[model samples]
Target: MRVEYDDVETEDDLRVTYQGDLFTGEVVERSPQGQVIAITTYFNGMEDGLSTEFYPSGERKAEGSARYGTAVGVHQEWHRNGNLAARLEFDDQGKLLSRHRWAEDGTPIESFVAES
Candidate 1:
């Protein structure tokens, strides 16, 4: 993957710019203990597909789909103990369409629709 960035020199001559790849692939980040913390997909420097996060113990913490850098479609999150914590839906414009939350014991606690 080729990463492209623009350089802007600061007053002290320090350079900085936005960074990312211009291709599609999985980007893995590991914790200090060498455990996978997150796995994300990218397309044209934007998050365009499935992405996931993991708990320290390797359990899935969240899973979701994105398009053009915005969260879209069904996304799920879970508690550290593995119980579902929430489910959310978003429109193509990245606006949340609805959301539902659950308790640690797997009981539904709240649900609501997003105002357009």
Candidate 2:
């Protein structure tokens, strides 16, 4: 079920309750002009699955996945002009695996891989 961000009550941390019950589904946050600014997925009141944030102009700003509130897999961010800004990888257990970043002009800024 999808719900407006204002309609949900935030509990501790990433937990949210909708209509007095733990929310399990998508919560959408909108700009004042009604443009979708963010979409977050929840499971049993905790952040899980994919969550995405968008620029006011509707370009994707960032995207990532989580399992029971712990970030996992690849998370990415982009500049408003459509260039990749950052990329991070995490193991299934939420351990950081790698990180890369680029400037808005697409120049490499940083790159690091966790030592095995």
Candidate 2 segments whose C-alpha is farther than 4 A from its true place: none
| Candidate 1 clashing pairs, residues 3+ apart or interchain | none
**Sliding window of 10 residues with minimal summed lDDT for model 2:** 10-19
lDDT on C-alpha atoms for all candidate structures = 0.74, 0.97
- RMSD to true structure for each model, in Å: 6.1, 0.9
Which 10 successive residues of model 1 have the least lDDT summed? 2-11
Estimate the overall C-alpha local distance difference test score of candidate 1: 0.74
- If scored against the real structure, what TM-score would every candidate get? 0.76, 0.97
Error of 1 at 61 (Å): 0.2
lDDT by residue (tens digit), candidate 1, 4-113: 12211112222222332244556676777878878777665567789899987899999999886789999999999889999999988888899999999999999999
lDDT, model 2, position 92: 96
Model 2, 1-116: lDDT tens digits are: 99999999998675899999999999999999999999999999999999999998999999999999899999999999999999999999999999999999999999999999
Error of 1 at 35 (Å): 0.9
